[model samples]
Target: MSQTDSYDDTYTESQVIMTTVKIIAPFTLTYGMFMSLHGADTPGGSFQGGAIIGVTVLMLAFAFGIEPTRQWLKNSFVVGLVTGGVTIFIATGLATMALGGSFLEYDAFSETFGIAHYWGMEAIEVGGVALIVAGVVITLFFATAAGFTPERNRREDEPLEGVSDDD
Candidate 1:
């Protein structure tokens, strides 16, 4: 095949990869959200959810191809980490201040929100869980991607080079 033909063939391969990623991303994101949302009331919570979501992106890259996976990871991974964490922290702080209490203390916010102090604490706990989860996911994902060794690159790029004929 000409160089152009080889390049064109990559498009087809990438399309297949993207199709698989599309199938998987929504389930992963939704599961993560569910875990975060019900963290206070359930067995599973933010840390598990965040890790699950981050792994899905990693899996997509692994199964489909790196380019599409990298795009997805690069696009929203940092945003998710920062926005989720900052939002939770700010909201908790503001709620505490509004309730005339110390930072992240929910007792005052309970009065402000007209909910029980217990419920307020629950909300804070959930937010904390989510922030922790997201932060870890972002940290791990970036670390893994950044430290991708030359061996990994060769394995992914060549696909067949590492295999032995004895197999």
Candidate 2:
């Protein structure tokens, strides 16, 4: 209501929000990691765990403005994370195929999905789902908050690198 109360360079009103997030974020993040790590032994799996981790990132964005979060996590880096996650999943499927099994048929490795210390599950669940979720959630937050139009325009106006405009 007052000029002093307005959002300024430092975001004075954020002190409380920042403090709360600082205190809670670590615990939530740790819990999320736990969920991801222990999912094989518990009820939840990558989906729930990934959502938790993604929520932590969202909470961070809320505490600190989207701009700061975006600056901290470049879009390229997040894209890499997403790409890596998908690659893990695809590689897992391919690995099974290479072993004369159906896609993601972990039972081929062992009677149970525990062969090789559950490496297959770990790759698909943790590497694929968790990373993808974390990257995508943060990327979505940044893109939506900062407006994805400029990116759309840039892509439409300019051809991709290494590709000719004539194509």
Error of 2 at 73 (Å): 1.2
Please report, in order, the local distance difference test score of every candidate based on alpha carbons.
0.67, 0.79
lDDT of 2 by residue, 12-122 (tens): 346889999999999999988888877576888777887888889889888887777778877788899789999999999988888778999876666544477377788
Looking at candidate 1, the ten consecutive residues that score lowest on lDDT are 2-11
RMSD of 2: 8.6
Scored by TM-score, the top model is 2
Task: Please give the range of 10 consecutive residues that has the lowest summed lDDT in model 2.
Answer: 3-12
lDDT of 1 by residue, 1-167 (tens): 43235223242356766787788789888888788777667898766776776677676656665566566666465666656776776787787887789877777855677777666655555666665666566566656655654565675556454566687
Give the clashing pairs for model 1: none
| Prediction RMSDs, each to the true structure | 9.5, 8.6
